[model samples]
Target: MSTLEIRDLHVSVDTETGPKEILRGVDLTVSSGQTHAIMGPNGSGKSTLAYSLAGHPKYTVTSGTVTLDGEDVLAMSVDERARAGLFLAMQYPVEVPGVSVSNFLRTAKTAVDGESPKLRTWVKDVKNSMQSLAIDDAFAERDLNTGFSGGEKKRHEILQLELLKPKFAVLDETDSGLDIDALRVVSDGVNRFTADGDKGVMLITHYTRILRYIKPDHVHVFIAGRVAEEGGPELADKLEEHGYVDYAGASA
Candidate 1:
């Protein structure tokens, strides 16, 4: 069983004033088949944690270690991490103007699966996922997120999630900027992907709206670049009502 563990992980970024710390000796452990949500205000290093797990070079891992099934994830390259069964759904998914959805999926499938999915089977599987998400098949012919609506872009991210089937996923504010309908669609897709009992989710978000659809097994309140409180799903409801003022003060 593949597990993602972050042990006293500290991250920093280069700044004029020297290194600015983001994640401050954070510790988390997520085994397969669990969903953990990290919620906090802006600059809480939620996204920074996600990016660091995915091996983004900009955020320096100043100390500690991240392990995937006991393997050192910190040592893996960006592509290596992806191949090692990690995925990140960015808060602002980037648009690639020249890459069609089909091409992108095929390339990624080849990379992750270590072989090309048979064209006939791959098309059917993709279409099935799209249908479940209420996505138009015609959308696949368009460039990857080029000229896509906000909802469309988010759904496209879900499409990748479904197709890639990563062992561990870091969804960075996937609920941000989504309308009610789009939120439901994206949430539905996430629920489907995380349903298989072999994957885990580390969801970083500021809002509780998405939690209604995909209930997290655990919730952590991030404060001052570290998790200040850890609890169950009820923690999300508490944060919804009271907000993070208490967390901010305590962490400070």
Candidate 2:
């Protein structure tokens, strides 16, 4: 089984004044067949940790080590990270004006696998995935995320997750804007991806709503860029009842 390890990770971002530190010494490990839920208040470095792992240029790793199966993840470029089996589903997916969803998915799959998928099987797979996600057939012909609703964008992200089948996925606030119905659809998609017990997930969210649909093996409470508590699914139930107030004050 593959493992993704983050050790004493410290990241920062440049601002108007200067470099502002975000993640201050955080550590976590996710192995295959495990799902870890990261819960925290706003500005607690949840997204920073996600982006840092995906090798976003905006966030700089000042000090830390991120390894995938013992290979240095921090050393690889963004695309190289994808090829290494890491995927990130952004909270707010950006629009790609000129790229059609069909073309985009095919291109990404080719890049990740180092070879193009056969036309016949690729077409059938894309069609089946889209139908399962309740996505319209015409969506494949539409430009990626252009004029798409929040739910549409999020669904498309999961579509990629389904097709590419990454070793680990960092889902950053994927449930933020989805309604109850859309939420169920999206959550089901994630469940299908992990049902095989071979994929790992780092689900970042502010609420326990999604956790109801996607059960995590471990729950971590992030306070001030550090994990304040770790437990089983019971921890999520506590968060729902007590919220992060107690943890916030302690971290202060």
Candidate 3:
């Protein structure tokens, strides 16, 4: 089984004022077949950790280490990180004005696999995955995220996750702006990806509604840029009832 390990990760971002530390020595480990949920108030650095793992230029790793199966993740380039089995579904998926979804998917698959998949099977795979995600066939011809709704954009992210089959997927606010039907479809896609085992998921979300469908194995309360608490599914139940007020006050 693959493993993603993070230890004492400190990250900084440059702002108008100056370089400001965001992630203050965050630590976590995710093993294959496990799902971890990160819940916190805004500005708690949940998304920062996700982007740092994916190697966004806006965030700098000032210290600490991140590794996938013992290979240095913080050292790899962004594309190399994807090739090494790391995927980040962003909070806001950017629109690629000129790229069709089909072309983008194929290009990304080729890059990650080091060669193009045979057109025959690749086409079939894409078709089936799209159908499973409830995505219309004609939507594939449109430019990526150009005119898509929030639900559609999130569905497309899961579509990529299902087809790409990365070892670890960091889903940041995937449930945001999704209606109940769309949420179920996306959750089903994730469940399908993890059903067989040997994959990891880091689901960063604000509400516990998605947890009803996804069922994280662990729940981490991220506050003030660190994991303030951790527990099993019960933690999420408490959060749903009490909210992040307790933790937010402490962080503030």
Instruction: Give one digit per residue, the lDDT tens place, for model 2 in 116-228.
Output: 99999999999999999999999999999999999999999999999999999999999999999999999999999999999999999999999999999999989888888
What lDDT does candidate 2 reach at residue 138? 96
lDDT of 2 at 250: 50
lDDT of 1 at 194: 83
- Can you tell me which runs of candidate 2 are displaced by over 4 Å? none
RMSD, model 3, all Cα superposed?
0.9
Order the candidate numbers by lDDT, best to worst. 2, 3, 1
**Candidate 3 clashes between residue pairs 3 or more apart in a chain or in different chains:** none
Superposed by TM-score, candidate 3 places the C-alpha of residue 87 at a distance from the truth, in angstroms, of 0.4
lDDT of 1: 0.91
Model 2 TM-score (2 dp): 0.99
Which window of 10 residues has the lowest lDDT sum in candidate 3?
Answer: 243-252
Residue-pair clashes per prediction, in order, are 0, 0, 0
RMSD of 1: 1.0
